[model samples]
Target: MTERKLKVYSEDEAKERLAKELPHWYVEHGWIRRRYRTNSWKGTLMVINAVGHLAEAAWHHPDITASYAWVEVRLMTHDHKGITDKDFQLAKKIEEVVQWQPGLEGGALEGTPQDDLRFAYIKYDKPKA
Candidate 1:
């Protein structure tokens, strides 16, 4: 498979694009950034380590900072000197491995809410009881 190149975009343009790629997070300091707050430090580190593994395997890395209950990730193409599609692709993979649902990207990109929230389909975060 051919690697997808991240299309570079301006700061404002990136935000608009990010709405589609990552509705919950936003671009900061010219990188795709997200902050995750968990209940346990151990869980956070584990997730960070897992993400690190994936990044290395993909040959595309995201800068991650973790301590206590928070893990922050920043993705940008240093070679490109800005953001690119690689950042978005890695974000998608992270979402899958981490068991997270991308935030509302302004509007529906697929089927209904029930369809999007199919418990049988998602294995990460469980529905609140």
Candidate 2:
């Protein structure tokens, strides 16, 4: 099937949609962005891997930046040269996978049993005072 051209959301529309659908994410420059803070470097790696896998599966990639304790995901449809429904869809999927927790859906914790004891489960860090 031929690919339909992606619709680019206007700035106002993007902000409005994000406010309602993904309050945690904000429109910045030309991209919708959300930063997930992890407990440590190990947590950071876990987040990066999850995002990579999801992005690959969806064939909609996001610009990712990882640090020792956080991973920032910026989504925009490069071909459309703006934010599109594809961006929103991938962002939502990323959020779901990033926020998943062990035992939440009978899913086993990632990594070995010993690693589980040593590596802290990835979590969104609280904002600093």
Candidate 3:
């Protein structure tokens, strides 16, 4: 199914954006948390650069914290007032770039243990004709 693109229409256009785009990341204290794991500080910086580029291109900005292993991004839409649509859009864009944990990027596996082990019960599988 296609995902619904959330709407944003507020004076604080940028703030509004965060509510939709980074639903999971955008939080209290007037900040959104975006976490990404990297091989080193250099890699982390590269991602920050990319995110910066994204922010600039979108004409929206975020406060970012970077370290050797991780980067935490905080987005707040300053123009429209509070959590505008643009913020959400940018959050989605940012989500495309970073990942914190492995094997859980998109989703987890859905098959039962029998799917992996041979001679195991395969209820999901049908008898061959």
For 31-99, candidate 1 gives per-residue lDDT tens digits of: 988776655665687679878998999898888988776788899887787888778888878866665
Best by lDDT: 2
For model 3, state the Cα shift of residue 13 in Å: 15
Candidate 2: the clashing residue pairs are none
For each candidate, the alpha-carbon lDDT, in order, equals: 0.72, 0.83, 0.59
Of models 1 and 3, which has the larger lDDT? 1
Question: Clashes in each model (backbone N, CA, C under 3 Å)?
Answer: 3, 0, 18
How far out, in Å, is residue 83 in model 2?
0.2
For 1-120, candidate 3 gives per-residue lDDT tens digits of 443445434434444545555444645565455676665666677678989999999878988887776777776666534555566668788776543322333467433244343422
| lDDT, candidate 2, at 67 | 91
- What's the lDDT of the predicted structure labeled candidate 1? 0.72
Clashes of 1: 3
